[model samples]
Target: KIKRMKNLPMAALDSETVTVVKRKVKTKKKKVKTERKKRKSKENTSLKGKSEPKDKKIQVLQKNENNSENVESMKIGNGHDIEEKVNEGKRSKEFESGHDFEVELPNKKQKSSFRKGNDVEKSGEVSTGTVLKKKKKKKNKNAEQNSELENIAQKKIVGIKDKMNAKIIQATLNTKYKEEKLKTALKKSWSSNGYPLKIDTCDEDSGIKLMKRLPPLYYAPIFFNFYNLIDSPSKRISMFYFIYLFQFKQTTDLKNASTPSLSALRNFLYGPFRKYLMNITGIELDNTVDMGSSLYEQTDVLLCHDDELEGRRIAYILYLVPPWDEKDGGTLDVFHTDKNGQPADIAKSFFPVWNSFAFFEVSPVSFHQVSEVLAKKKRLSINGWYHGSPVNRPPKFVELPRPVKSPCHIEQEDLYSWINHVYLDPWTQKEIKTKFQKDSQIELEQFLAEDKYEALLEAIKLKDLKWHYEGPANKRHYEVTKANKAGELVRECLKFLRSEAVFLIFSQLTGLRLHKLAPPDSEDEEEKSSEKEPSPCVSQEIRRVSHGSYTLVHDDDPVGSQYALDAMLFLGVSEKWTQALGGFTSYIARDEDEELLTVLPRSNSLSMVYRDKETLKFTKHVNTSVKDLLEEEQQFYEVNCTYYE
Candidate 1:
């Protein structure tokens, strides 16, 4: 989920909305004069004073156009002026239309089926519509039942009033009142057919198995949050919030976990709620609910991960929010499935509603993320995992495609062509190697051939071409062109990177014995089925790093990982790109707080570096200060390849 405006529309995070970490009440859009119809929800889970909050409008000012050369050149506008303007728009919209925000759900067919406690076995793949009809019973809303339920609740409350602890929470959950109320909410949730479970599979073409998916998620409702008997502290519960507020300035930071305070919320989740989950889903959850609640605010985001932790079976989130506009950010954006049946770009975004309870089975294709919150509001939720069940059929592991062997030596003809495209001469190459030997990193500007670079720049502007929104927003936010669909220039770039000339050049420049270069594509079935031969290198696709595009820090390289030489060739960049506006890479020594090197993604610059055991690197997120004069202005078109020595 997005911490603030950073996650919503990365392109929109200029100088407009302000983000403050706190709890959110729902957004009220309309009021009616119709006679009050008594509500049934109160009878079961009565919080008489805890009624749903109407919309509380916080006026946000749209950022003024400031493509001024410097990142700090943005001029701040008056808050009062912006607030008044927002009010004017709101009033007029209310007069003209019944709604304040536009509600747009994507048009997609949903197939979901779940039966009640009795019909579990037959319900696995049945139609939800047919089963829900049988589940909902017409119970009259009368004072007699309400009073009886309230009386039972008072007795249970008085009986367990002593020693406000975890046992009490577990006992209360077993009580008929809590069980009945939660059961009703769960049944309604399954019956409502609110979540979409489509056959979103992976694209078999790519080796990054993560991009493929087969997901059918459950978006649990609001009442799910209060299922626990413990009274969660008013101060909340989001550790994701403080990370951005405190550590936004640091470039190497990754995710922030929960701070221990809200024992009530944690106990409720791990205790009785766990039992209720078993009753509904028919899966035995693990003993402990790893109580790590995530809070994503402005720029805070959880990138793409499969959540394949040991002992974890299902991943769950209970949002502590009132309803609000979907555009407010804090959405659970499920990735679209690639040809591999793995998760790909973001296909759908589920915004945080105060009472939302959403969960999904942790599997290979279960790659999901939080989009940037474009608005100034807080997206708060409690997240945990239920472990100890048989891993929902793990997808077959797919290794990155085998290396495409190129010649070990560079021919003179290839050298000349490379020289024409890139401005590196023998002397400059010598200088680069010398600097690399000392620092294990070097940046060479004008690295791409002039004509080739110019042609590719034009090719990227083609509107007919489809660019995948590379996601799991916590890890990265950008787009990538499918090289197969893209025409000549993209093809040529791929070839050039994999060419014997460039490989030998890089090998010599870095003093590494690299032989083969790997492309980011899957191997043939024969190759996949056969015994794997030892390879000399590993690499990935040519990526288009655009606005809000980022790579967070993590201990990614395995002990025996084949990544010896890493290269990032920057292209398609505008002159307006500045350090203050991000789009830079940060290299840090794992043992210290110091950032070892900062590499800017300047146009036509290639930064090739050696990875030491104690070092890690990441591309800083691109900010919204750039003019975006052209569509490509937001992009860092580059070939990130690797070599095994």
Candidate 2:
């Protein structure tokens, strides 16, 4: 007889726990079926031929059938514990196939077998595959949750970065009044009908109509009465002056500043502002920042330049100055280029207005400069270039052929009449030659005859002389005497400096070969004479130096571009002249910022310097103080002569 199990109630479990228990029950049922097949096969073998044992075999078969029916009943029961089925199935399989496998219990009235089996399973009898399957499911759920969290974190990071960039842009610009106006200004095509329209924010009915007829040049300026919340990056800048050579004070290395406000402003301009410009101009701009804070004190100036470096797309300035006007002399001046691409006349001048922004496209014709600052208040501004893909540049401009040199063939008495007698002495000549050879330069004080120097000084101040102004203002700005337009004494002084006698004398003094013959001190004179004689050539100019006069190192000046022996005869300089009033010539190595030498002006002194191709020279701009020190003319003269062999 088979035992009947009592139905038992159980606490509800989660779906996953219940599923694990049910799968274990199904595996036990499969094992029970295999046990029954083995028992039946053995019963069939035992009953093969013995008739006397047939009745007993039949009874054993009936008992096996009853056990199978009891197992099926256990599987069908709702409250049967899965642990009981697993343990019962194992016990049934453990018995030998020929042994009787019968349950000893009363039907429907015995201790519950499932409860006993639950106690057994609780003593650590769970299968390894069931534990591993539960662990794997939990791990998969954790992995999915971690991926979702990472995606959320990544999105937050990107959003924060974008917000920070926007904040920086808004802080640097006074967008309340300027943003919409700027957007409106950029809407129009930069150039139209062969002319560029002006972008002026001060007035609505500005020069747009008039500009249609003007030459093609792009210019924009934004003026506002209000200031931004961010401090001006240029206000606290330290300055180093170039003196009168270039004459300005500017901050060096304007990147990665320690100051918080300066760093923030730099980020704004170099990042968001650059992207805004790229969008407006439709050009690919670079990420690098090039900028500096500048301070222009009184008399400081920046001469004309196009800002046309490789990859430079646009030039910009943000004026952080006080109220200003044209009289202040620190205006941003734009120039028109002539047919030869040289800066010509000033096309427009924009005075520094407090909190104004200005910019222009950089090109071969975009010549501009900062005029000399005349006000005592400092002119403060932040200026820089926005770099982009480099545009196709025309070949470098080659200046017109230099004026032909005149042959040296004047009388010897003419030289004697002007040159100091001390310079004529052989012993004195040897001393100058020795010094010149050592330094490649010399200054001869009282270089002319006493009487001749006195006459020339007085003649230079004559009002009858016709002065021709020289410019494009980029390279030089001064006066040159018109042909036959100076006094007779002044003309004679110029002629004396260009004479052949002076050339040979200069050769003996400086030990340079200026004629067919070698210097008097040369050892192999016969050998030098046999060689091809260098053609002796000379060119001279008489320049009038006054307030604002200057000569810059430009490609157009032969002295700046080639090797030459330069002799400068200074006249009419007052005894009270000081270096502070400028008008000194400075020599520096090519492509270098360091000043190598400075030649200060003194009346009747001659400055001779042999400059190689690697050297460049410029006369500094004379300030208004020249008027107080000199006579009413407020000017002096320089007889500049260059010798070529």
Worst 10 residues of 2 by lDDT: 92-101
Which clashing pairs does model 2 show?
none
lDDT per residue for candidate 1 within 1-645, as digits (tens), equals: 101111122111112233222232333334221212333234543222122223422322232224211111111111111111111111100011001111111231221222221121222544321112212134433334334533443344333332333333331222332556545644444321224554433323221012122445665333432323223333434342212112221111112212122445555567777787777555678776665544445555555567877777778876765556886665777776566655656766767776556776676667777665556555666667888856546455443443444444445665565545333466766676678878888887777668767777778667787877664343445677777898876776666676666665675566555533322123563364345433454454667776567765544334213345667777777787777556677777664556778877777777887776677667766644443447656565777766665
Query: Any idea what lDDT model 1 has?
Result: 0.51
Query: Residue 119 of model 2: what lDDT?
Result: 24
Tens digits of per-residue lDDT for model 2 on 524-630?
A: 75566567667777777889999889877765565566668989999888778888888889988877868888999888899999989898888888876676763
Shift of residue 161 alpha carbon in model 1, Å: 14
Question: With candidate 1 superimposed using the best TM-score fit, by how many Å does residue 369's alpha carbon deviate from the native?
Answer: 2.1
TM-score of 2: 0.68
> What lDDT would candidate 2 get against the real structure?
0.63
